[model samples]
Target: MSKTLPPAPWTRRDDLARLVAALGIENVRWVGGAVRDTLLDIEVKDIDAATPLLPDEVMARCKEADIRTVPTGIDHGTITAILPTGPVEVTTLRKDVSTDGRRATVAFASEWRDDAARRDFTINALYAHPDTLEIEDYFGGIDDLAARRVRFIGDAHQRIREDHLRILRYFRFQARFGAELDETAEAACAELAETLKGLSRERVAMELLSLLSLPDPSETVARMHRLGVLPVVLPECCKKGVEALKASIETERRESEAPDPIRRLAALLPALRPVAETVAARLRLSRQQRERLTCAAERNEGDVADPRALAYTESRECAIDRLLLQGASTTPLRGWDIPQLPMKGGEIVQRGIATGPEVARTLRAVEARWIAEGFPDRQRVEAILQEFLQKRS
Candidate 1:
């Protein structure tokens, strides 16, 4: 790996160049994930920098440079500078004054090493000069990155005590980038696994979903289960959930589909609607996410055989999830757009079914027949409606 921040498209942007110049190249260094990922040659999604200047000073510098600034986390000593390329988050160097395993109070400092020490993982504490692109290592972050190791900055137990969410974050980073788990870190995470319950459900859900989104997280997740971490966070996940997740990944790869976190979560859970719903609620998932998860949990034993019918009856998205979980083929649904029922209740009323409950019932009957007939054309829907009307008469 290069000793300096590797050149990438984001690094080559003219707007970023101006922003860096405005922030004073000597006063700022690219920090955190941007620096870590640049070294690892991964796709960098967000840019972050650390500066010795206070948040107000950072904002003032951006203003002088004619750059828009957002007080994204000003209380935490951070400001976001918006450039033509995108927003770059610049935070004043800070050392934790106090921590309660949830939030930290910090005082801004002028030393980069102080900020680095406050970070959770050594690999994430790397800093890179914007102009020189030279790397700065206060801890052996570069070496840790080279070793594919994800370890805490100082004491693993102390780090976990400072923020309970780091327990889940450890496994998530390991799943994505680690070749071998640091034994000390693993032990600390295991010992402090229960502390994870103290963290917010939203934070836990975010980390879990990110882990599940990875190409293959089965091994890492299984390791977490062995360490009792999974039991503490998600006792609802079945003992066989890891195997199901592996199966789900293989099925997704076979079908050439992207890995979906919610669907994979459905695989990890017991195939029961209530169980899925309960887990979703516990995780505080969005309404759409909850619906998809519960829908995937539905028992559709014989339904995967007719992909279209399954899609029509229980949504294309849910049907795809069920088929993937069942290890069935999703080829039939490729480019097969789901269609409407092709008939309306108003049209049925116009056909003299009376504008009452009869019309609604008659419409539903027609829809059921239409769905059974594979969602035929409007003419076929008309014929189905006529059959229902005749029966009602």
Candidate 2:
């Protein structure tokens, strides 16, 4: 008796079957996250296969089959097969020759176990034959998966040392899958936490945002703070920040909204625009992202009484962020299409106001009144403009 790959939509694809045929079904096995997720009944998004076929050979075979191929990560032995379904990566089995706590220099190997050994986690190293659907588990990945435990491949310390980004990845996977923490893995992560400094901020930001995007990452984030990991990466975050994250999660649940990582990241920082801006800059966030983070951090008490006004003033997104973090009702903002002010500066100018500063000031007065009156209709806006003009006269 042998373990079989679980049945799923991805397994029924004719294009995938053709891909396996092109590479010789016996030469390749579906590997990594696709195998891991499918077995767990998680919807598989990306498909990857491992083979002894060299990258060039993989490309040549696909070309003969009339399937296009991209030499994505060719030096790392990965070639992307463009299928009608989606791009699937076919990589040669590899063994690490050297690692610098950030990246690995690898040599292609013919053994599946060699490649599996180099992966970050046991659950991620499971493989399944394309034709037989029989699983090849060199480690106790199946048992670990059943237990909902996230464990490193070999020595936890050695695995983290091989790629320092694994420090953050450990918490992320644990947040997504683990029920009980693997103490050995946890200890290794705690000890090697400093090694995360060597990783690119972009890579760190990607992993952090991913973790936060999960349904609820408050507990995992608090654990990271306890283990001395969060401070090393984001010192701006404090105990209060973790508490704010908890509040934010509760509000998202209340509002029936999806988890927002950038908004959550804002919650995990002090409520100072400068602090949020600083963290945003350090994380290399985009201009829009930096603005959102800063906006979420700065709470105006006046806005709390009227979320729509805040939405009109700043943005619907920023208004939602403030409301959720403030433990206020996002109900007012939900499904409500933000409306534009019905009057413009040109409309004010037509009312005998001068073109320069006076027209701008009167237009602002009319817009403010319209917004304060709940984004009234065009007729009402005309009335508001008249009132402002009479007041100025």
Best by lDDT: 2
> 1-393 in candidate 1: lDDT tens per residue?
667888777878898888888888899898889988888889999999899999888888889999999999999988999888789998999999999998898999888899999999989999888888898888898988998999899999999999999999999999988996799999999999999988889999999999999999999988998899998878988669878888989999999989999999999899999999899999999999999999999947776768888898889999999999999989999999999888778897788767899877887888888878778899988888777777767
| Candidate whose TM-score is highest | 2
> Which residue pairs overlap in candidate 1's backbone?
none
C-alpha lDDT of all candidate models, in order: 0.89, 0.90
Clashing pairs counted in every model: 0, 0
Off by over 4 Å in 2: none
- Candidate 2 clash total? 0
**Candidate 2 positional error at 263, Å:** 0.8
> Candidate 2, residues 1-393: lDDT per residue as tens digits?
227996778988999999988999888999989988888888899999999999999999999999999998999999999999799999999999999998899999999999999999988999998877889998888888888999999999999989999999999999999996799999999999999998998999999999999999999999999999999999999999999999989999988878999999988898899999889989999899999999998976766899999998999989988988898888888789998776678776777877899887777878888888888899998988877767767
lDDT of 2: 0.90
Q: Residue 262 of model 1: what lDDT?
A: 97
lDDT of 1: 0.89
